[model samples]
Target: MKPFLTGHEELIHDIKYDFYGKHLATVSSDQHIKVFDLDSTTSSWILNDSWKAHDSSILRVSWAHPEFSSSKILASCSFDRTVKIWQEQPDELHGSGRRWSKLVTLAIESYAPIYDVVFAPNHLGLKLGCVGSDGIFRIYESVEPSDLSQWALTSEIPILNSSLPAKSLQSSFAIEWCPSKFTTTEKFIVVALDQGFIYGTKPGGGKDDLQNSPRQQSPLQQQLEQQPQSQQESRYIKLGNLPEHNGLIRSVSWAPSMGRNYHLIATACKDGYVRIFKAIETAKGDLKIEILAKLNDHKSEVWRVNWNMTGTILSSAGDDGNLRLWKCNYLNEWKCMSVINTSNRSDNRGIEVEPK
Candidate 1:
């Protein structure tokens, strides 16, 4: 932890960490993906582990399965309309000093440019989800789609809930599915608007409109239908309509796993507001978003907000060319834990957007 890890060609769009805490990865708008590791004994020193992962600017990258860390799988999506899966090359690192071999790449064909990617809870190791610029959520089944039978398609979870306040294509920046398919009854998704509106869905998520489709009785539709009546109580339940940032909602990430009774969220807004929203439990249909803390230290629009693999803290980045970490206080509020100011003397994050 030498205050910063060196090496990246350009601005970073998102970061994902393995559950094991030893390996971490980042996707950059520069069209590259870098995987890094921290020294076990000295945690602050960041190692540079990188590969040219995509043809165009990368929009998202996520850990495929850290529950199985050695054979590391990282799924990355980009403006090139491709989703790629990368596994660690064995005996790849030359020395103990922080270098690894090129990634063994496999492409998951996508119809459109993918902006976000996530792995579904593992029933089989192959289930994964991806969302594109068109706001269509497509779940790809094959590790390699050319193997069509093994690479079957899952239903697409369309983003525009015809009934809710939909953010037009010109405004959306990211889509995130809950990490755990925790409940057997429903699914959860967080839609981040470029204009700062963050909307949420509960268990039988988006059932109000997701059930009806041109193809009657799709697998997902059946999943929606078969949910026990009791579980459908808040199906498509609209949580808080949080005003995230002033410019665009760059990114949104749900906390990893915590066996708790409530939900917590962290969002990075264009207005440079790194916000934390806590779910207040109740019997009503409205999901309450209590802004537990507001961070205004950055000088530019914040591009992303992600809770660490463990959910105890969150990391955010922006046009400002800096990375900041925030931690929760005993009062359930968030405060700045650490800050990496700039890669060089030239980068600075600053903006004048009005607060949302």
Candidate 2:
């Protein structure tokens, strides 16, 4: 692999490729976001834009599908307790030059640091999901494609069990929206919490209203029922929670469904393990999840997990400074296919050699 120096002063927290993989966006602890464009003629990544984006470390960045509009859009979350939306603009004076301009900023009502933000699939109309230190999951929708600044908080759900004391609620670490919708009328979002539990929730109010909708009663609803009548109304229904992990969850990813009957969800944890789950729709039309694979190849905390565009391959990075790729075999067993070491080493000339 060929590597180009990024010159980031601090550790990069996340890197994402655009829908077509023609552009790359990287966010770092230095509170900066940089965009790079791949030049087809020279086969080189050229630095296109760089700017300070947040007051603190930026944790995650997400790219909206280009099909949403003619120009690309991006979303980023940070430790500064805010999420920002960016739009790519053409530089008419400089032909072939494109730059990103901040379009909107979303600050959580609680002013909590957001750990993750992701754009929903193209089928979902310009929607974004975010999880944060407030133990709350929020959904924002842009009603007008021309005016992204007019985003509305479509849904807000407290992810923690209300029966538990407020102090017991833990911050959420990651969240991902299911790429496939069982029907044109429904959507799913999976979230990972620092309390070692992963839960799924469906934002209410689609083609059908919540009162007329049929779904299994979740723990959140049960807790909500115990409260006063004024608090009974909710726009989100908890799907269910998965088995607890050994340690806090760091990242969660849902694979893109490619005409598959079941969906795959991968979670990376502080326990240094990567677990994959199979989400299947039961006869009653509710989601039933079961652990498909538990992989423990990392010696340190597993920080991130992602699925390839085809949903056939999974890749993970960890505190061990290594990235591993996993694939399923003919027997339907997941196994590690390759590992990339990122640790630095000293060479013969007293020079440091970094992993490519």
Candidate 3:
């Protein structure tokens, strides 16, 4: 495949691929969103569309499931405290090229700058999850899937359960949905603020009335429930937390189960460490979390951590300007399989080793 230089004037904040990997969406601090399509003939990327999406620097961009609409749909959040949706439409005026049009803008609840926005798994319907400097986890769902613009705020829950002010400008937040379609009963998303916490939707994901039904609670949730009455109550249930992350979390990614019984999540932190957590559901519906591996190979603040499609291999990047690939062996141990240093332009080859 051939590479083309990006036209973004400022630093790119996020890049995401569509569900089928046919299109790529990138957002930048220049307040623009660019979509690139794969050219099947030349195996190269072609700039499909670009537009000024936000008033301030765009922080994140997410693509909805391909099946959600006949045309491509994208969701973006920015420092302007708004989440905007765009849809690809036939450009009647141009006649040849398709163009993107703003579908809707969501900015009612978020008082602070939005940091991250993610679309839920296709199985969960057309929904978007957002988090920002306000420390609120907001869920918006399109009740009428065919009409993408018709969306309503379904839930607004605090990221932290304690009374301590959750709002902070120094901290960043991220959210990732559970991608397992086999998980039929419970639907949830993991949010990363000071640490990683899993929050599950109630019986009905929409604006359902608060139900005090009996349910099993993890030990951590039980402790959170014992807090003072002044603490704000949330509709979403707290599933569990990724403990021992002493510093602020930069990113969190959930791995595709690929038929695995348990779930795997990777976390990037400001403390110069990368952590992987294994979560399993018990018979009582409580989540049991354990640290699978902790790596400090970056020796600097970790920026991002993501898992491969099959959940077999994991990749991490940090402030050290290096990208590392990690994999687990049959013995249930993880090791760094490869490293690519970006500092030296001449020697850019990746040093790779066998997984086992």
For candidate 3, list the clashing residue pairs, or say none: none
Runs in model 1 deviating more than 4 A are 3-12, 28-52, 68-70, 89-111, 121-126, 142-149, 161-172, 180-186, 195-245, 256-259, 281-286, 308-312, 318-340, 343-356
TM-score of every candidate: 0.64, 0.82, 0.85
Task: Please tell me which predicted candidate would have the highest lDDT against the true structure.
Answer: 3
Which regions in candidate 3 have their CA more than 4 angstroms from the true location?
A: 92-98, 161-169, 190-192, 202-235, 347-356
TM-score of 2: 0.82
lDDT per residue as tens, model 2, 241-279:
666588778888889888898888888888888999887
lDDT scores of the candidates, listed in order? 0.60, 0.73, 0.78
On TM-score, the stronger of 1 and 2 is 2
TM-score of 1: 0.64
For residues 1-356, what per-residue lDDT tens digits would candidate 3 score against the true structure? 54467789999999998988888888999998988888899988888878888889999999988887888899999999999999987553321334888889996677888889998877666778898877788877675565677776656777765543445537678888888867534446555456677876444442221232111111133433464433323445787888998788888889999988999989999998899999997665557999999999999999999999899999999998889999998888899998876563424254443344
Better of 1 and 2 by lDDT: 2
| Residue 236 CA displacement from its true place in model 3, Å | 2.4
Which scores better on lDDT, 2 or 3?
3
For model 3, how many clashes? Answer: 0
Clashes of each: 12, 0, 0
